[model samples]
Target: MFNKLDLSKELTGRRALVTGGTRGIGAAIAQRLLDAGAKVVVAARTRSDDTPAAATFVAGDVSTSEGVEAVATQALAALGGLDILVNNAGGGRAFLEGSWTIPDKAWHDSFALNLFAAIRLTNAVLPALRASKAAAVVNISSAAATMPFGPFAHYGAAKAALEYYSRTLAMELAPSGIRVNVVSPGVISTPGSDEFARTTPGFSTDDWTRNIPLGRLGATEDIAEVVALLVSGRGKFLTGANYRVDGGMTAR
Candidate 1:
């Protein structure tokens, strides 16, 4: 549950864009930024009831170059300029018998969604990002990148590339005062993950909890809170860093 009292004006006057912000973790992050006083544009292929009413919604996919351009254009037009960019549009295909059984298209689609989308969108919005006095880019990754789950090999590999890209981008943009960071989440409780758990064989939410030091799946709000802080002045000094919000799963 998100605490309404957690709102702050720390991001006042900032403009932000969150990809795949219609539902789940993306929705939570957009809402948190709005609550923190930032003008936000939420982009997705479709809008849902869960879409934050306070955010300007842009209907565009981020998985292709054209989609990335459309989304970046509309989001920039909506906000005038961008200060914070959250590349959160990402997901893996259904669980396969093994990585070898996964088709070539699945690998391409995985990289398109998890890696290329962020790369293209960042390139599209580079001008606006560079123009801001306090710019930040937060790329959402996954614990699978480090843990390397056999069933989600493509996803893990793409996220691993994204993390490396983010670090290198951070180094290149540091002198310009732009900050880039990665947030890698563990098994999180969301409608998408819930459905995946139910449909995938040999994957149990209970089993996941037993391995987590916190003894529970993470909430979307948990990821949202960290994102809000990272995009705000509170995380001004942080760049090229990966914050794993995994309840100590990676620590173990």
Candidate 2:
């Protein structure tokens, strides 16, 4: 039923930047965009061969202004211009002491990566995105933004604000033809998520699968596929929306 959507060259000639794209869901997104003929750029603090060999690598952290500036300059220079931006670099260290006793530095780091990084990077790329025929911005949020549990208040609060900011940003950028949206993924199996399964209380992927309506944890490819569609012409009419890729985890 979904086959009518021709994505053979949906992103041809496009320039895309995926932050924290060296691994996990970000890696999958980068690969999909590259396969669709986009000039993809993957950005992170470090480099490894695992990065899509075809995509240009921009090694810069997104958690600080200096890093963001470096990434913005290098990306624009490398790609000449940009059309798709995926603000997918966001994660927080555990509040080992206690959720309420989370350190000030942890809070600052969380906001920097989970919220402000996207803000700063988006502003830096606005001019370039504005010049494109159809620009798209997709922020990778977490299902925790709406359903928080156990020491995630800090991350959840930041992502919640991110969603609100994205909605407002969408309103402001619509006239300029830049679409802003959010993708909230839930329990996707990745190296980063492997620890959660073992550490987080009762967070067994095998058990959760039966509880999740889909009867399985999501794959990185699931998110990659949705993001591919969201940034392509197929989603030309969508903006200011928060899409959940959870397997009915939130429904229950």
Candidate 3:
């Protein structure tokens, strides 16, 4: 049955750029794309040795304008061009509840990381995406965008904005043969999730996993497979779609 999925046929000859591809969901997406025969370039603030075969790595922070530009430049040089742009670099810790003590600076910082970073990077790669046969952009969103977990008010708001941005960009770029979409994932078991569990009081992994009807929290691969499909020809007719890969968390 696994062989029958035929995922590989969908991505031959494609070139992709995955931000934050050195770890977690981004790393999983890079591996899936490579398995499907795409040449993948990964960009992140740090480097990792676990990169898939034939993958190129570029170092830069994608949250700032300068960082986004540096990554785009390096990715283009490494991959020769970009056909798929996976905006998987955004993340932050604005989900913790704190009324007056949180400070306004924290809010802005969260948006800079989780929202502006994707916007800036996508903007930098528009021209290249336009030139490819399968021009697609996949923005990694969060279930919190709509679910409204109070702990992460800022994070949720930023993710909501990201969803809006991706849909609007889809409308504007469709005429140019480019597709844009979002993948909103639930709590996945990653190093980041482990860190969050450790820091956030009462937010145990068990607590989060219980919300998933699938009986367990999602893995990075669960999100990555969906992303690969969206950027592939198999997902050609899909755009402006926000898919919630949350193991049924949103269903309830």
The number of the candidate with the highest TM-score is 1
In the predicted model 1, the residue pairs found to clash are none
Q: What lDDT does the true structure give each of the candidates? A: 0.93, 0.89, 0.87
lDDT score for candidate 3 against the true structure:
0.87
**How many clashing residue pairs appear in each of the predictions shown?**
0, 0, 2
Candidate 2 lDDT (Cα, 0 to 1): 0.89
> Each prediction's TM-score against the native?
0.96, 0.94, 0.94
Indicate the worst ten consecutive residues by lDDT in candidate 1. Answer: 1-10
Error of 2 at 181 (Å): 0.9
Order by TM-score, highest first = 1, 2, 3
Give candidate 1 regions above 4 Å deviation: 1-7
After superposing candidate 3 on the true structure, give the runs of residues whose Cα lies further than 4 Å from its correct spot.
1-6
| CA shift of 132, model 1, Å | 0.3
lDDT value, residue 97 of candidate 1: 75
